[model samples]
Target chain A: MTTSSTLRPGVGDRSVTDPGPPAPRPRGDGAAALAFLTPSIITFLVFVLAPTVGVLVLSFYNWNLLSDGTFVGLDNFDRLIHDGRLLGVYGSTTYMALAILAVNVVLGLLLAVLLETRMPRWLRGFFRLSYLFPFVVSASAVALIWRFLLNKDLGLVNYLLGLVHVDRIDWLGSSAFAPVSVIIVNSWKTIGFSILVYIAGLQSIPDQLREAAIVDGAGAWTRFWRITFPLLSPTIFFLVVINTINSFQIFAEPRVLTQGGPGDSSRTIVEYLYDRAFGDFDLGYASAIGITFALILVVLTAIQFWFSRRWTFY
Target chain B: MSTATTSMSPRLGRLAARVLTFLVLGIAALAITAPFLWIFRGALSGSDAELYRLPPTFDAGTLTVRNFGRVTEQVPYFRFFLNSIIVSTVVTAAQLITCSTAAYAFARLRFRGKGVLFALVIGSLMIPIQVTIVPLFLVMSKLGLTNTLWALILPGIFSAFGIFLLRQHFLGLPRGLEEAAKIDGAGQFRTFARIILPLSGPSIATLGILCFTYWWNDLLLPLVMISDTDRQTLPVGLVLLAGRFSTGSLGTIAAGITMAIVPVLVVFLAAQRYIVQSIASSGLKL
Candidate 1:
């Protein structure tokens, strides 16, 4: 997964880039190595590798959980082609992912840049703590909390809006607001991560770059555009890739908060897959969705890496 | 950034920028923190009515500690909590052992097809759980492990990311220490246990916290793997509580959520620097 950015030179060299004195390479440690790797090997083979193959095989079979799957050939994929709801699911998933990427990457960049400005040390810590705390919290728990707070009639959010004389918005109950509500919950929970990563990214940039820009009479906006952002491209690239992948698999938020309700307005692909596999007992069809989603991720990630080359500064 | 700008800007402009920065940061902070605080206060509120009341009250005098009690009474909160603890702790420990040993092999030892083996481990990171989960469920059922906590624990114990992280850490370590240990006639296990492991504490802590936080907060895995209420982890139990009692008990559910998040939040705040450092450096997310 980390190897998605292989197009970037020098990013993958951490393992072999040791500057230490070259001692004799320990050869023929195969027995010990095998002993050490046995647990991981067995588990990985059974859990990860085997199941990956299993998904491809399972896609061709129409089986429920109990009985043996009957060979269905390309029927599942055919069903997938005709599944009109799927386009909507993919739309919602991509919308969620892109919206999250925008919020996380853009707002996070702004917040990170702001935090880097002059402030009390404790204030900086407070900002970081406030933002990053939710990233560590469970998504299910967080979603439940948001669900409670996003309730149209009883939620604190609506209550607070009422205090300002705004009419109550159906945060979760409506097609218009359900997706937005999920986005808010997801973004609120995760934007802190982007802030923290971007802060680290900002810190790694040499002070002299910005200083040199200042000496050239570059204003704040210009300095940021020319000096700060270009240097932060790699960080931007990293966050964009990871956050996109994570958000496309968005399940817990919609599952708990909306359950893809309001006539499937807020449904995502993974949520759709979950409904098919577990809820509807359509394992074969669900596997088709799974394989499709995985392919999209690989293709999308490869596209991101390909695009990153033009802007990602070394 | 501000200090650099001060030399070129007017004092008034700088002050305005500083204030504006804090102003924006203040609103963002409040937006981020308010939900957690509201939930906390709701968890401690005296009644559901108060929790849902407009112009929401956080009046300390009227707050009760009983919603938490209600959460416990309604569900096997402690059982779920204990299950979460057991799963997270065991998974962390297992990952430490498994990842470190495998990482050591990849880092220090030579073997046939090492490159291919390491690539296999690394390559699996790209496979999301959705792809593998259905078959994993099948495997668990075949092994008669579905609906058991083992279903939750077994699949999580091995992480390709963990091995990659610790392998990188091990590669960065000085080989002289291990060479010295070998010259002292210590076996590979003794050298790893005594020297390599001790020096790699920070990396271990980073990986340990990463795994613990991940497993503790994970919902989908437990939701799919453990169907039995007795085996359910906190996230699963909380979701069940939400689905089973959506309309009636927001306060109690808030309490359940607060309990789920607080201990982890406390530990995260305490180890904030290391966790942030690890994520920033390695791009590892829970």
Candidate 2:
């Protein structure tokens, strides 16, 4: 789309109307593009590209800042495989991520459908704004807010539970409950984004399709499932890809709340990786975990992409 | 014409559906905003331990600014606040200048290696900061940038997402713009500066806002890079405040959280309508 315009900026009739060869392009276009691209390319190389290579290489060799440790090929990878805690970490992380994704997709779709129905426009706008308001707040703040609210002794949640003569569930203090608490916290933090995206996706669907379905003696449920849901698949597919990747990188919520505590019940891979690198000062092992986690995300995203072909409708 | 004879059942059903919408959305909205409400409540509840008592009472007399005062007095709240502002602003500005230039090249210019370079740029998206943090940490320490704002700003100035976002918008721009500029004897640089940049204001603004928020809300990187408490960003600072108050009532930490989020809250409230709409439209593009 853009190259054609760049090639024939002023006129496009050179091949059709002119018998002579097309005019030679200006020598400055490539030069300008190079110069324009230089700053970002340099930054990308130094910060992004270089570190990517650094992690891959670092994973293969045991090295610290002060002493250059000897090379140990595949040892880091082997260690990651043998580390029994990894299975638990992966399980909890997947469970948490799937819970988060389910909340985002299902609740997000529900919000979109609700807003699509009869409602005051202002009310819809206000809720949308309020929902996204928490998103702008820093992750640490969200963590802190939830920490306060879920305080088993004095938190508003437990306090309200006490009002109804119900025992307060351990929101963060217990192993079994911490993962669920962070899921709720993290879900609250991120669900607005998907809801907004779904709203946008909902708007893109044509009204006539739903109208035709209804005219053909379809109930509301049938119309939605057969007509609207299939049409919203592209958006769903996009969110699934984006959110799954994001959910895998869950760090701050668990880091700040459970600290992978109550015996690593809420431990995410990123958090475990963080502890290995920073807490243990085990750079090589951390790099290995990093590479492994990155590969998991890449593979999962690729698989999602492959599956999307069957379900995603343009 | 027969629509005026609609049965009461359908109207009642519609009413039930509308009421259900309100019921469901209202409950969801309540659950969503519950944290913010609790934060506000905790921020207001000071030494009055009743706020911490089971079946807490939120009396007007219990509200106090003592915890806010404590937060400011205990930690260098102002320094952290200023550091966040400066770091996020510089990152945002540098990104706007850098990401757009690169995006323009990928969108409008055709070089021999454009496709490969663009793919590499997209490839960077798969490499999250976690994967790069250890090496970046060492690199920063080597360069003596570890406790400075430069460590935060410089590494963040390059973003694959920013480039991707702007490139998509630039590709959709009308071809007549650059053609008109070229017909008037404008060179590539002149056309890009005068016509293309002006026309891509909304895309630039969206990217700028996103980058700023991303930088501002950053915790993990700052936690790794900035060890000196004096140089820490607000997120790090909040965590530190929490650690210090881990033993006592959470009032002071709540106050610190409130302080940290206030600026972001203002920014959000100011541009919320525009941000939400732009986010939606950008979704369609992606």
Candidate 3:
């Protein structure tokens, strides 16, 4: 009966009644498919595939804008291991990315869970919009606005600090505060996105389950631990993976805010790579860094995917 | 009696939950709004307003249009705005056409090498643009496309994410509808135009909003691609203004920042539902 119902549309009465008939191929299906896929294929090849292959090839040879190529086999990779500034840059980038991810996920989840409760509809919407406002603004604008707010002598942050009798600190100029400032700004910009994702995940959970838990006398904390928290793992897992990838690639904020330092304090890997290629005109080394960064990202993402299998409910 | 006792605790718990929820939301709201208020205050302050001075004041009487005037005169503000609008609009339009057609093929068609080709498309997502910058720049320079808006617009149009997103949306659609149209003697092209295109409004809006916002606010591409001052996008343009005003006073820079973000913010406000929905459904899977 099930087979008959499933076959009714495609095969009609004859095929449904007779258990052994060959399936018919639609006419022009191949031609039609190729015609539709042509644009995407061409675009993928030109922009993504070609450029990727180019980067891999460029990594093996020493070719700047002016000079002809010299195949310097593993030398670039070798230098990457020992370069002092490059090492510092990697440390700063990883530290900053992880910091931002931690803050954003924790705060975002908290906010999402809060907003999902009995808040007024209009109020919830307003808060969501406000949270996401920083994201919608351009990165340069965010940098400039925050710079104004954080100015040591003349900025509002210090002024506010004065009211509380706190000594003014150079938020952007100090090495210690500069990375923190970047992380704060990035978190402010990105937490909204994480919050929105969490809300969606939160909404997907059936209220009946919570109600049942309550009827069985499960307290708020208990209900959350046993029910809500586990359900939210998938969303959390997704955010962590994407956020980590994005963090490793951080550039604009540090560039605009501190130019990567009160020294080399805030130099991220991408900034380091940029300097090597454009600042010093060392393409081979830059390509090597790029390759390394890509490999790290792949490995990290794979681990996340593996861990997700255990924790991600879906 | 026991049932009554149990109900009493649950009711109180509900009340507590409500109150706690409000408190958390209020704090989140403040965190989000604080920066915006700071920006607003900075933009409106007079030139002489001392930085780091306690009790920040924005006396409406002291506010002036001086910063706006300075932003316009000192930099090519209008030109940057024009460049951003033109680049973003062109990229969005081109992506719409390219992504939709491609998505349709992936969803409905069965061609040779389709599996391998589709894998390539999805795999490209893992390759960040940073890795490809050198080669892309080299190619652009060779083509004499550097410093031109085409450099930004062309690359922005062909996104793997866009293709993947539209394909997901297309796959969710009922195949029976398209099949019925096909049975009516409609050719592939005809069915696509008369059937598929019209049904794709929601997905298109999602892609359009995402693409527009991305290109509208992009910084890295413009920074590297365009060296000429007039060719800079809004982000680059604002950075230049910031550099010009980075000397003690920030009034002009604050005003420039405000102006730069307002249009995109307004678009975000209007289309927020679509934005939120798209972001949610896409699952930040990228």
Candidate 4:
């Protein structure tokens, strides 16, 4: 991966595109290279590659840890398309992904810009630490802390609402509110990441460009749109794809907090996959779900990559 | 961007802008830090009543160390702590060793199949462990290693991101030093161990801290592989504790959470620069 990006622009490099002259291999480089690469290669092959292939292959069979798996060609995919539960699963997963992505990208950008310009120099590091502490802690801890905070009664959030004479709400138990609550907690945990990225992006925008725009009498918002936003598009695109990939695998939050409660209102696809695979012992169907999930990621990522070119300056 | 206000606006305007900036930052910081504060107080409070009390505060009158005792007694807290330490340490060590060696080969050596192999390493980044959990579970059961620390540690030992990071670092090193070492009767391994690895401190620290944070907080893999109570990690153990004390013991649960987060927080503070550097650098990479 590193080499391709470096090698792509080269015109006629013999080192690449030609794996020729293999009659009598030089023993010197080959032996040392083998020695260095053996451990990680073997580890990756067995743990990663084999399992990736296993996911694809297992999707074609009907197996439950007991009897030998019977091959059922394309039937799992057929079930995947028609599975009614999956409709809700995919819906919830997409909702969470888009919700979290919006918060991480937009809210994160706003916070980064606010801190970049508005925050006092003496307090910048302290504020960054405050924002990032949540991200540093375990996800389970975050979920459980919010679970406590969102409890029906005797919860800080509800108590705060009671201060204004508003009735207490079941933040995690209600179908209407669970999704919103989960998204908020997940966002709270992860938005720090986007803040950091956007801060870096904001700083990387050379002052001269903005200064030139200001010399032409551009206002704050106008200068941001004309001079800053375009240059920050690459960072924005990266955050969108990365956060989407992350949020698509949202399991621990809902699993710990709500357990897909209120009639699967907060169920994510990975939790659904866990249920089919482990809870139901339907490995074949679960593998099918995994394959479908991976495909969704691939498509989402591909769309992002394709769309990036239109707006990404680089 | 204080320069924005200072460059154009009047002194009073600049003062107002500065106040506004601090106001926004202070509010955001409070929101972000509220959970930590609540958990901290709950961890140190006398009882669940104190924990659930509105206007939660750290009053010397109500504070006690009893919850800390309950945390240890209620669950195998120390055992869980030990398991987390051992797993994270072994995984971190393995990651550093395997990733650096593979990275050195990819960065410097000229050999057949290096390009394809390097691509394979980088490509694995997109393939998350969740996708392969089922087959991986099967692998564990086949080896009869279920509920063992090895089951949790083995699959996590080598990551594509680690290899990619070290390789990037190695590529940035000046070739002169290595060439001089090579001419001065140093072997490839010697040059890598002495010349290359010594100067790659920042990259190594970044990757090491990254791996430590990852293995320390890892939940899904362990949740799937380890079913035994004594074998469970801190995150899983805390989840079990939460389920057990759902109706009571908020103080103890808060203590458990505090215990769980302390090591990670300490790690973050100690290696604060590298951890943030890791995140920032990876942002650029992506």
Instruction: Report how far off residue B125 is in candidate 1 (Å).
Output: 1.5
Candidate 1 lDDT by residue in tens digits, B1-286: 4556566667866777777888999999998888888888888887788888877766879988888888888889899999999999988888888889888889988889899998788677778887678888888988999988888888987898899888888888898988886665555666677888998887888888778878888888887787778889988899877666746777788888888888877888888888777666655322
Clashing pairs in 2: none
- Quickly count the clashes in candidate 4: 1
Top-scoring candidate (TM-score):
2
RMSD of each: 6.5, 5.3, 6.9, 6.1
In model 1 chain B, where is the ten-residue run with the lowest total lDDT?
B277-286
> What is the per-residue lDDT of model 3 for residues B1-286, given as tens digits with 9 covering 90 to 100?
2233455687675676677677777877886687777666666667645323356665678777777788899999999999999999998988887788778878787767778877887777778788777777777787799999988987776777888888887888888888776555555666677788899887788788778877887787887789999998898998888788547557777778878867777777888898887766556333
lDDT for each residue of candidate 4 in B1-286, tens digit (9 for 90 to 100): 4446655666766677767867877888998888888998899987788899997767888787788888888889989989988998888988888889889989888889988998788677778888889998988888898889989988997789889888888988899998776556455566778899999887887788768777887788889999888999898889988877867778888988988887777877786766776676666654
Tens-digit per-residue lDDT, A189-253, candidate 4: 99887888788788788999999988998877788888889999989998988898889988889
- Show where candidate 3 strays beyond 4 Å: A1-28, A161-167, B1-20, B50-53, B284-286
Worst 10 residues of 4 chain B by lDDT: B1-10
The CAPRI quality class of candidate 4 comes to acceptable
For candidate 3, give the docking quality class from DockQ.
acceptable
Better of 2 and 4 by TM-score: 2
Q: Which sequence of candidate numbers ranks them by TM-score, best first?
A: 2, 1, 3, 4
Give one digit per residue, the lDDT tens place, for model 2 in B1-286: 1132245567776776777778888888888776676676777787637446555456787688888899988899999999999999998998988888788889888777888999998878888887799988877887899888889988998889899999999899999978876665565666777888999888888888778877888888888888889999998898898898657757888788888877777778888877887666666766
Question: Interface RMSD, all models, one decimal each?
Answer: 7.0, 5.9, 7.3, 6.9
lDDT of each: 0.83, 0.82, 0.78, 0.83
- TM-scores, one per candidate: 0.90, 0.92, 0.90, 0.90
